[model samples]
Target: MADELKRRAVHASGAGLVALYLLAAQFDLGLTWDRFQLLMGLLAVGTIALEFLRLYVGLELSLYDSLTREYEQNQFAGYGYYMLSMTVAVLFFEPRVALPAMLMLAIGDPISGTVSDDSLKFVKGPRVLVTMFVVSALIAAPFLHETPLAVVAAAIGATVADGVKLRIGDYIVDDNLTIPIYAGLLATLVLEFGPV
Candidate 1:
């Protein structure tokens, strides 16, 4: 439980990136969207490099033992996927869709993780799914209030991403990669097509 709590703590810390992005934008701190996207892209590249070193070059880091799950030992860790997803969201989606989508992964996923039973494997329980949806909806509401349909769509996307564990061959698709991407795509669709 202590270890899980520590993981959750680190998971929740991803929210700081969103906060920093928002604050920088609001205050005109010189971190524009293009710059932010570039930074995220660099981070994604760095993580990929690290994963390559760890998986193929036989580089071992102590932090991996502590921060990564058993399933991640032989594969890319969640942090890499998290960075990749955030980069994808920011680069491909508008701020209105991307910000809340990032928040859904950063804030909503950690909260859902806290209530989830990892031992269940593959899929989280119904309660965890509901919690994910509600939290994701709340996180998105202030940003997407004018488009209620977008908000709901984002929530549903995040919930589905968080609740299901999809596998392709030997690799399990991490929610860290899916959550923001799914949320952003759904929200963008709603904003584009849903009634104003």
Candidate 2:
């Protein structure tokens, strides 16, 4: 439980990182969308390079836990999945969509995890669902232009994505990858099709 909480704490810290999207959205950062994509691309590449080095060269970093330390064996370490998903979300969605989508995962997932007593049913229980939706809606309201519909969709999507523990052969899909991508796509769809 302590390890899970520690991981969730690290996960929640991504909210601060997602806040930077606001600067780009408002054009305060002087970053064009293309430049933003380039930057994210660079960051993704750098992350992969470092991971490769760490896995192949036995670069032992104290920051990463045994989960990532065993990256040579585990192709999809949590941090790698995190960077990959974040980069994909940024590149795939517009800033408006990406910001709230990322926030849903960043803020809501940890909250859901923290509140759930049962690890197996974490985001699946009814109480956790309500809490996830309310917390996600509140956090996303200020940022999402299509507040009501998009927030609701994002909240639900993030919850579902977080609940998923899909495995493909040896690798398990991380929620860090699932949450933002799933929520972002759902939010985008809702914003496009659902009534405001």
Residues 24-96, model 1: lDDT tens digits? 9889899998898888888889989989998999998976765688778887888888889989999999888
Tell me model 1's lDDT, rounded to 2 decimals.
0.89
TM-score of predicted structure 1: 0.93
- Candidate 1 pairs with clashing backbones: none
List TM-score per model, in order: 0.93, 0.81
Cα lDDT for residue 63, candidate 2: 60
lDDT, candidate 2, 18-94, per-residue tens: 65655665667777777777877887798788788776877767666633524335464776777778788889987
Cα lDDT, all candidates: 0.89, 0.72
Candidate 2, which ten residues in sequence have the lowest lDDT sum? 66-75
